[model samples]
Target: MPDDKTALVISAHSADFVWRGGGAIALHRAMGYAVTVVCLSYGERGESAKLWKQDGMTLEKVKTARRTEAENAAAELGVTDIRFFDVGDYPLDLGPDTRDRMVDVIREVQPRWMMTHSKWDPYNTDHMNTMRFTLDCRMVAQAWGHNPGQKVLGAPQLYLFEPHQTEQMGWTPDVFLDITEVWDRKWAAIQCMQGQEHLWSYYRNVAENRANHLRRNSGGQAGGRAAKYAEGFQTVFPRTVDALE
Candidate 1:
């Protein structure tokens, strides 16, 4: 971790951060890192069976419910800011300007670490595109580090969070965060996304699975890995090796 750093997450949909990396966000916040979330879409097309259970809920009503849920989830994780791009929700489309816009945001934030979806997630097309596009923007932004007129930024550590289909997505973890202390808060964060009925049980199971991973890695250490819960990440470009790599 960098000194007094800010951590940012660019999620493909509003519910992604809560479902996948909520513990990581909570851990960062507990450690005093300023956390921000950039949700590429409002996730209107996402699962909303729970929220839609009410009588005669229109699309506008669903949108309102999801927005509130996302806001509440961020608050639970102690996030400082959450920005929604309101981009189309079905699947993330990184056309052309999306990449540039993400680059600009990265330069502005210049965070010490960034988290987002993995590139091979088949569960959601938008997540894969978000992963691909964000990585693309990350490289382009770093390449222009010294160029005049571009926001200056030393490349930040990038971590890929699990997608909806971790097993199917071929997610391999190389980093684990023991979010034991903030596990309750992580649960609280995920519970905020009440719109996604399909997620509640699934994410809780994911949490337990990752917790087991931590336990195995820690060799039953008191707290280091034996912690009851955690989040795992697969990193790209682990360290800066050259001016241009």
Candidate 2:
């Protein structure tokens, strides 16, 4: 509903977007871009360790808590829309229906840019599987023959946000977004992920480390910008431009 200026984030789990790209979401939203996040699953089975440790936590209870957390996080991040597929995680899959649904969302949003998981994640196959499904669904959305009446999607830049373990995940950052101004918002969103309390400080540290990288690469030690918080991303496709910035 925000014209052609929209961004889509295809996350494997409810909290994946928060940990990996909350700053990017908040930053873009502040720049007048409508950010929409899609969570493939609640991450109940694998990622909700805190909730599971409770005295008696049912499957539905875990799902509800995860959903509420995600919604609260999205609001804090200034997200325009947050969709939950609720397909379940652990070993995330993209069945025919799910694939079609993703394609539909792509067409509907007609995003100018998109973000998703890395191509590989040894620690969590669900993260890798999400990348596969995102690419597959994007292809379907681009094909005019798939759905005659629907509009075909344009080639949008897909950026892979930082994973928990970038070393093993083989993710290299080509862009570092200075999110100091919106750091508080990102922190608030991070707090909404109560199920992963242990990661709160971990991700905050990641942001600070990325800010250091931003400062160094931006101007070196002598003239480096003073960015206190930042988010890193790896571009999945080559960026084309007529002139260098």
**Best candidate (score: lDDT):** 2
* Error in Å for residue 222 of model 2: 3.7
Q: How many backbone clashes does candidate 2 have?
A: 0
- Report the lDDT tens digits of candidate 1 across residue range 1-245: 34347877999888888888899898888878888899888777656667667898887888788889899999999986898887777766687778778877787777889999896966677888888888888887787543458766677788998776677988898887788788888788888887776678887887788888888877755654566777888998767576862
CA RMSD (A), model 2: 1.0
Per-candidate Cα lDDT values, in order, are: 0.81, 0.93
RMSD of each: 3.9, 1.0
CA lDDT, candidate 1, residue 83: 88
How much is 230 displaced in model 2, in angstroms?
A: 0.7
Query: Would you give me the overall lDDT of model 1?
Result: 0.81
Candidate with the greatest TM-score versus the true structure = 2
Position 56, candidate 2: lDDT: 86
Worst 10 residues of 1 by lDDT: 144-153
